[model samples]
Target: MIQVLEVKTEKDIKEFIDFPFKIYKGDKNWVPPLKNDEKKMFSPHTNPELEFCDTQFWLAKDNGKTVGRIITMINHKYNEKVNKAYARFFKFESINVEGGEQLLLFAENWAREKRSTHIHGPLGFSNLDNQGLLIEGFEYLPSIASTYNKVFYKDIFDKLEYQKENDWIEFILYPEDCIDERILKLNETIKKRYNLIVNSFKKRKELQPFIPQVLEVLNQAFAELPYVIPFDEKTGSYYIEKYFSLLNPNLIKIITNKDGEAVAFIVGLPSLSRAMQKANGKLSPWGIYNIFRAINHPKVVDLALTAVLPQLQRQGVAAVLITELQKELIRYGVKEVETTGIFETNTQAVQTWKNFKHIQHKRRRCYVKEL
Candidate 1:
């Protein structure tokens, strides 16, 4: 017999967070998340989104043995904007096909109650977190910042009648590889014409002067994106200070305009999968050591974010950004890069990597249904 239990208390919530650690226990490709960090999202006190969304987390069990988990979420903000009923299943899991279908059925009906037309997910409550499933790259080790799933996982979705709605790509670049001479010449020309420079932060202190400006640019650049709610000063500053502090300064390049404004740029952070896996997402004395060590010892650089102001778009700003970062990767002995999820509909961002020969190695989809 199987049963689905909704997350209602601390104990239930912990199971949802730690279940993955046990599921992929010996799998070398698995990267465990930070427990405290994971907990914050589900905690009513910590997850600010609860103010605007509703979520019901589920755990699947067979004869009282926990087997899988999923979250059925309705972002009111999403429904109100698109005028539809939709739900997302984040951290979906299952040991049996039957059990998994039950979880989906529950969420499907939840959407149906709102008179939804179709249901889609494996998405987070919002875009800031992981939002896709892995339809490819099972043969490679999943990075700290990317998603990984068993081939069977996709099969489960198919059996449940879930269809692919979008996909994105991750690429690898080597320092030894030379940028095409023509492109290099063009970048050189653009640089001289704009009086621009492509470079990374050499010290934390150096970024203090411009980090605020970078935040301003980010807000402006991303203002028109859907489902995006601009972060306030405190939250935005927290992200820059907390995240930028851990990044490999070498892998982050700030592209400036002739007037000294950072018009286009790329920011990459060191992957901490190994450390998080070791800590089980704890940060006690020893856990802190693993995290600190991961800073300088990151095996993969998470290409966290890239942005170009619309005024500078299609002007080779993207290419210049990548070229400078590639040089930095070579200097720091880095091997791989994982980018943030790109909208599947955003073809311009997809085709921007003309030099990389990207393999479309990852796929994440978002589904829509009418309310």
Candidate 2:
């Protein structure tokens, strides 16, 4: 018989974090998240979002062996904003379809007890957190910001009658093929015509002050998107501490208008997928060394995040940012670029990728079932 247990003790939490490593063994395309980071995300003292979200973690076991794990969450803040009682399940994994079904049933019952009308996931505390199930591109190596799973996991969702709620597509671009001479020239013209100034950084200190404005632009730009909660000061500061150090200063581009206010920004990181794989989810001495080595010499760059002020959307700001960043990528001898998930319905963002020599190699989805 399969049994489900709520994760409450330190040992249980460790099992929850370690379950993926067991399932993805020998999977070259899977990247392990830092174990320390995973712990921090679940701690109330560390992750501010926990203050407003009710969450629980579970493990499914059969004959004393772990078979599956899942997390159920209800973000009260988000529920208030949208005025809907929607629950979410995330980091779901299982050894087989039966284990997966038991986990989902547990989550569905938990949601119903909480008075939620529907439950959807592979979502996290916020958009910045990894979300979506990899419905396609199982062979492609996932960026550190993306999620990966066994192909059979989709079968579990299908059997549970979960309907697709949304899909996000990822692309791979060759920097050389993506750069257009006309776009480069047009970037300059756009800068002059709009009195926009492009800022490139050589050091983190040079980029520090503008961080707040970048978050503002991100909040404004993504306000209308489903499941996006505006970043409060505490949440923004938490992310800055977590990810700012991994960024390559030279790959960051910020655009400002005549008033010197940040209107748009793009942040890219040297791909750490291989380094994280080497680390095996621990930041050991050797793991830290591998990460630094990757940072200094990267063959692939991940476009982690980009945002423009809502009023400035479609004014060629995105193109200018991309052009500037691409030039730097070439200078750094970068060979390939990987993009974070872009919603399939986001036509404006999708159109920007068309100018590049690219392929829609990966697709992830969020699934929902009405209670």
* Cα lDDT of model 2 by residue, 21-82, tens digit: 99888889999998988888778899998998999889999998999999899999899999
> Each model's TM-score?
0.86, 0.98
Best by lDDT: 2
Task: State in Å the error of residue 364, model 1.
Answer: 3.5
Candidate 1 lDDT at 115 equals 60
The number of residue pairs in model 2 that clash at the backbone is 0
**lDDT (Cα atoms) of all candidates against the true structure:** 0.71, 0.91
lDDT of 2: 0.91
Clash pairs, candidate 2, are: none
What is the Cα-based TM-score of model 1?
0.86
Candidate 1 clashing pairs? 84-371, 85-371, 117-370, 118-369
Model 2 C-alpha RMSD to native: 1.2
